[model samples]
Target chain A: MLSDIAFLFYFFSLFISFIGSCIMFSKIEIAFKWIGILLIVTFLNELNTRFLVKSLSIQSNGVYHFFVPIEFSIYTIIFATFINLKRWNKILILLVFLLVIIEILNTLFLQPIYVTNTNTMIIESVFLVLLSLILYIRIKESTYYKNLLLEGVFWFNSSILFYYAFNILVWGFHNWDFINPPLIMYDINAFLCGLMYLTFLFSIYLNFIQVRKLKN
Target chain B: MTNRQIESIDVIVFIVAGILVILLMFGFILYFLISYKSKKRDYNLLEIQKKELDDQKKLLENTLSELRATQSQLIHSEKMASLGQLTAGIAHEIQNPLNFVNNFSDVSKELLTEMREDIKKNNIEDALELASDVVNNLDKIYFHGKKAESIVKGMLQHSRAAKGLLEKADINLLCDESIRLAYHGMKSKFMDFNVEITTIFAQNIPKIYIIPQDIGRVILNILSNAFYATIQKSKKISSDYKPNVTIKTLYDSSGVNVYIRDNGCGIPQEIKDKIFQPFFTTKISGQGTGLGLSICYDIINSHGGRISFESKEREFTEFNIFLPNKSNLVVKIPNNVV
Candidate 1:
């Protein structure tokens, strides 16, 4: 029953993100297009993980593993677009290319189709944590002296940094075979994702207000 | 270390570092919020300071207007002080014209009676001659009446508080008028006063632009002081000691120059510097408003001119004035103000 509520909350957050993305599409345009695409892919992945695991008798674990590398790569591209630091940004792109090659090799041999790709997920979570740190630094060092609470970039960077940091911890616990991870782990994962998506919606709203102020 | 132990350490390090980074980001955001609130407070304070400055500016404007009011009051007081001298001078000066009028009226009355008698006796030639004599007396009477009217008019102009404009004026005429007014005015007060006033006027001096009334006031003020000093000295001196005031006017390439010298009690050394200060008077209170010399100094400075004096105590005092020849008026002088 708890799992069911987690699932419902996850879909509710996705619905909110979808509405926010549609609003942003009509307004600020291309800045959020990639993020919207990422959310759509995540929504499809969640749907498949819920239904396909039982009905089609297909391994949803393999699908989750397969999609994780692609998601991380897409995140890299989005960060590259946002970050003005050309040197670090190019290195992040190179890292994405290397990560994709490694992921392909892991899926074919080390982690077969039925197995959970905990190793790759852990690696992706680590990279997300570091990248989120870099993004936070960029927001902090910015000369924007206006209200930080109202700043969309500040909120977005904070939400991502918080989620991925916890994500690294959860995936790391899965890596250690001896440790019996708590049942609440799944709930935490669902709640964190929901909260992250809700923050994204908030960021979009802030951007809209700022853009309207500028135009008027 | 074993491979398993190394893997565990790696997981531990990643989890710890991730938590630390999140904590640091939260710290940065809190700092930003606090800083922004403080800046808003400072901006509000700056707005209040601007409002206070505007209020102070209004207060200063009010003070400046009050200062102007005080200056006009001072000018009025100086005019009142000179009024007494002006009335006394008018009395002494009008006596000559009045005597002429009286004598001419008597002569005309006798001539009219003789002409009537001649007409009654049928002597037409004598009656015609008597009629011509009566007409001559009437003309003299008219002339004397006009002269008396002019004396009253000149005195009225001097006594009235007039903020008159600058114009082309003969400096010598101003000095002569001042000497007449001051000497007569002094004589009326002294009763038995007699003084020698010698004028050495230069020929064909071109009229310079000046505020005729203000310059008149300056000359009258100086002449009155000179006469007062002389009268005071005369009372203490022997019978042979004759008080003399010599007025000389000359013009050269530089400008017009006026010299008013008095062989009176010269200004004492101790009081010379204080003479031109407002309300600095040696006379008992109510006898004078000591704004006279200060007003004179301001008037000359405004005209782009200068006035200076030289004196030896109990010997002589000479005041020298220089008016510019060029049209370099600091204050604009208009025309026909007299």
Candidate 2:
């Protein structure tokens, strides 16, 4: 029942995020449109993974292994656009390819098909946290006239940093008997996903409002 | 690894991550608060400085307007002083016409008295002759009376303050009248002084737009100075030496140019540049206010014209004034296209 409630919470947040993206679609910039599309893909991924696990009796690990590389690659593009560092963008593309290769290697040799892809998730989370921190520092160094709270990027990147760091820290103790409680971990993951979606909804709304103000 | 060791490690790592998150949030909050306060303080400082600058600008504008008012008043008084000096010459000019009118009136009165006596004595032919004489005398009186009236009218016109508006003006008429007035003025002041004057007026010159009173003042001032210089030079030179002043006007596609040249003690090189400076004079004390040339320069400049002089020391000096024609006047266009 607890796991069902968490799943419902995440689905509700994702639905709200989808609605925000639709409202912001025509008014927002190209980069923002990409982010909105990324959110929609993540929502679909979650639904597909659940359908595969419950209805088809298939392991979710296979879905996650396929999704991680794609999800992180989208994140790489978003961060590359956000940070606006040319040299780092090329380096990030190379790193993303390497991460993809490593994820494939872990799935093939290190982790069984039925087990959780903890190694790939941990690596992805750590890289996302680092990129978010770097983006935060870049934004802080830039000249800004709007309030930090009102800035869409600030909230969006902060959500990424917080969610990924929390994910990695929690999953890092997967080897410990007391730490890897399956139900509690699932609840926590679902809560973190809902929080990220909520922040993304705020970011989309703020971006829409800002663009509307500029048009006026 | 043992279950107890793994659990301890997990708890420690979680505590450290949570601590890091707390510290980062606190740091961001502190930085934002400091930046907001600093920006607010800068905005307040800029507002105060802008207000102070505006106040200073207002004060400067007030002082500038006051100074302009004083300058105009001084220029008016200078014109009045010039009129005062011209009064003697004007009075002398009208004296001859007055004499003609009085002499003709006396002869006509005598003729009328004789005609009345002849009519009473029944001398009809003699009365008819006396009536013809009286008619001739009356015509002379009328002619001289009109001349005196015109002189008075010209003086009154010059004395009236300028309205400072551009109007259709005849350059030749203006130049001739000013020359006559200025010549008589100087001659009346210096009874023994004499200078031969010549005028070369451009024929069929179109009426141009000008502030008549101001331009009249400029012409009068230049003539007065030219006459003065020649008179002074004549006083020092031999009796055979003839002091001459020439006035010329040219109208063409380029513009209207007026040259007032005088054979006199020319302006020295060192003092030529200073000639248009306010209160600059080479005339003897009490003879000049030293504002005439400077005012002339300003009047010409204000009319979008130029005033310059060419002089040969101890020989001659000439002043040239060039006023651009209608084609050269600045035209203002509206912001919106038609």
Candidate 3:
């Protein structure tokens, strides 16, 4: 059942990513480029998870466990920095860089305090919540892409928040009875993230319309 | 998933997306460059057409001025030909009187000699009667001969043929002569009505190259209009009120300006625009040809100068003429070079 769920997730992500790519190809604006890039990255990550589940044995001790948080942190920081660099201050750049370096160092050097599946899930959830909060603040203050960009950020942040909260509650408290129903929660995140990508693409199209109107 | 697998997937996606973005950006830049170049070409074409149109307008104005000058020369030649015919008629009329003066003078001289011989023989009554007849015949010959000579002289001056030749001439003297010539024709009609003529001439105006006859004609036309306007107004008002006309001239750095003004029945606005048009007259049938102002307009235009007027109905009218000082020399230079 876990392998089947992983395959479905992988295919679903690929389908969403394909649609995002077509949107990017259609004379879209600059902001959507970032959203498209993020969607493709997530799709690849899901596909990799699907492959791992198919080829390898099901085990709590996975070699990729330590790399996930480090990879997530690096990608999020890079994307956020690129989009917000026009508003960049030296202090903000230094703070975000410091946080990324610390996360990387922790993933590379720190040993596990306790051997449990819950600990890994708890750490990942906490990091996702922190990243979502930062992204929400950045998106709220931005004026260039306006309502559509804000809608995108709202969907993306809420999806991440819900996923993290659901995971933490499901694993940290050992709530095994609700596990089957909550598996669908991951799909909900995927759907919401797809909607976020679509809204971001529409916002770019709107910007193009505005530019054409001004020229005439 | 293994860390190496995840890292490979991320690198592949990044590379693909980056390539797509670079290609799209290049396409946009190319489109913008093409649009900009076409807009610039359109602006340049519009500018060139505007310059060509301005050149055409200037050429048309020059052609119009030349046509006006040619027309005026033709009219002046026609007037001169008619004047020559009139002069020949006057000469024929004087010839008959002139012959009698010559024949009678000779006959009277012979009679005087015979009477002188008779007087020497002491015939007192016969000598007295013959002496009275000789005195009477001498008076007739002197009076008739002098009258014919004065008439010829007046005809010669009125013809203005000698004055038409270019010479260093005073404009003030020319104005006075033209006024005298016009008054000869106008005085009889205005004799019973009170009319005053005044002249204010400017001194030391440099001699200008012109045909004095043509200038004389312009002065005559303006003075005629002034007299007629005044006469018409006086008839409407009290008979005792005297009409006044003033002629004045001024010389400046640019040119000379002549003004003829009168306290008269001023031209109405409706007729003012048509005043210089040929055959457009306010006079009754057979009273005026209406070619006077039209001819004046043509003459001034040919001289590379202008004539204009101002009038307030029932109050006053002023005709202003400006003739450039060196216009003849300036105009000839261009023709000579071309």
Candidate 4:
């Protein structure tokens, strides 16, 4: 029962978080819409990975290989659009497109579709961490917010930094061999995924507060 | 242990080490959040304090304006009080010439009646003598009437300045009138006190443009002070200490200077610095308002002039007034005034 609970924990959290984001959809900033869409997609992906694939007795790692890059692409779009008013947005989007093509080739030629895309996932994590740190540096020197905690920009940037920084640990120590048990990896991934969704819910609620204040 | 289980331990150990490193990095983010929060709170507190100080300053400015209004009322009353002091002297000065005119008119009426009776009796020489006597009596009446008219006109000129109008006035003559009014006012109040007064006015001293009444008030205030000082000295001396007040007007290239000196109880060393300060007086309550010299100082300052004094305690006190008559006048002598 404990294992079952632990297994379904992150999926349930993502489902709830996606519903919350949709309910307050109109109140969120323009920069946060992509984040809301990312939540629903992630929730559906989690449902397929945790329930559908397991019920069919097939490999779930292949689904992650697809979902991970989609998530990284959305994050990159949001960060590039938000920072510097999208100063190098065209170049950044092109860079991600090139990375996606490289990732496809990597999956086909080096790792294969049935296994994890470790190289591309590690590269995505590096890019997200770098963007988040750049955002943090800008926030440190800014005076635009009455309270940073109530700002969607602050929450989105900081959460990216937090999750991706820790995520580097998972990828750095990934066990590719079938001889190793995947129990610890599953536990760490579920915990981090739950934490990330929780932060998303917080950002949505903070955006609601900020919208209400502006109306007043 | 089996080989598979040993391999899992190594994987767990490596992942946990990576997690430990990220945790160390997370500590810095936590510190940043805490320090930023603290700085924001301190800045908010200072903003509130600064707002409070601004409100306090505005309140203080309002209070200062209220005080200034009350001081203005006091100054007006001081001017009226000086006018009140001149009232008793005005009455005494007007009374003398009126008595002479009335007596002379009565005598002239009697003389006319006698001449009419002599004409009825057909006594021409005697009637002519009575007519001549009547003519002489009328002449006396006319002279006394003219004298009364001149006194009334002089008093009118002295008190005519209600709008602070600048006009050329004989400074020496104003000094004489102010002295007479101040002396008579003091005498009416203190009948037994007497002081020998003398005047040494300079010749060819042209009439300077001034608001005569304001300068008159300044001279009156000083002369009043001198009289009061002399009166106080008299109580102690009583036997042979002769009191004397002297007025001298002199003009050089600098300005017109009037020196008013009196042998009296002079200013004390302790209160000398406070002599011209508002509400500073040595006299007992109800005897003095203490605004006399302060008003005088302000009046002189407004005229682009200055007032100073010299004193020896219980010996003598002299006030020197230097009024700008040439280049220092802030006011122009109006085309009609000069």
The numbered model that scores best in lDDT is: 2
lDDT of 1 by residue, A62-99 (tens): 78666887788778877776676889878898878777
- Per-prediction DockQ comes to 0.13, 0.08, 0.01, 0.23
lDDT of 2 by residue, A1-216 (tens): 888888889899998888788778888876677778878888889889889889998878778888888989988988898888899899889879988998889988987667778888989998998888788677756655447678788788878877787687666756344335444555767877898888888887888889999999
Among these predictions, the greatest DockQ belongs to: 4
Sequence-dependent TM-score of model 1: 0.61
Report lDDT (Cα) of residue A111, candidate 3.
Answer: 28
Q: Using alpha carbons, what is the TM-score of model 2?
A: 0.56
Please list the C-alpha lDDT of all candidates, in the order they appear. Answer: 0.76, 0.81, 0.60, 0.77
lDDT of 4: 0.77
Worst 10 residues of 3 chain B by lDDT: B329-338
Q: What is the TM-score of each candidate against the true structure?
A: 0.61, 0.56, 0.35, 0.70
TM-score leader: 4
Tens digits of per-residue lDDT, candidate 4, A1-216, equal 545675577777787889988888788776677788888888888778768576888888788778877887888777775775556687678768867887888888977878888777777888888888777767766545667767777777777777777666667667344446445765766676677787887787788777878888
DockQ for model 2?
Answer: 0.08
Q: Report iRMS (Å) of candidate 3.
A: 16.1
Residue pairs whose backbone atoms clash in candidate 3: none
The candidate with the higher TM-score, 1 or 4, is: 4
RMSD of each: 9.1, 9.8, 17.6, 7.2
- Give the alpha carbon lDDT tens digit for every residue of B160-238 in model 4: 4446567788999899888888988888889896999989999868888777877887898899889888999989786
Candidate 2: pairs in clash: none
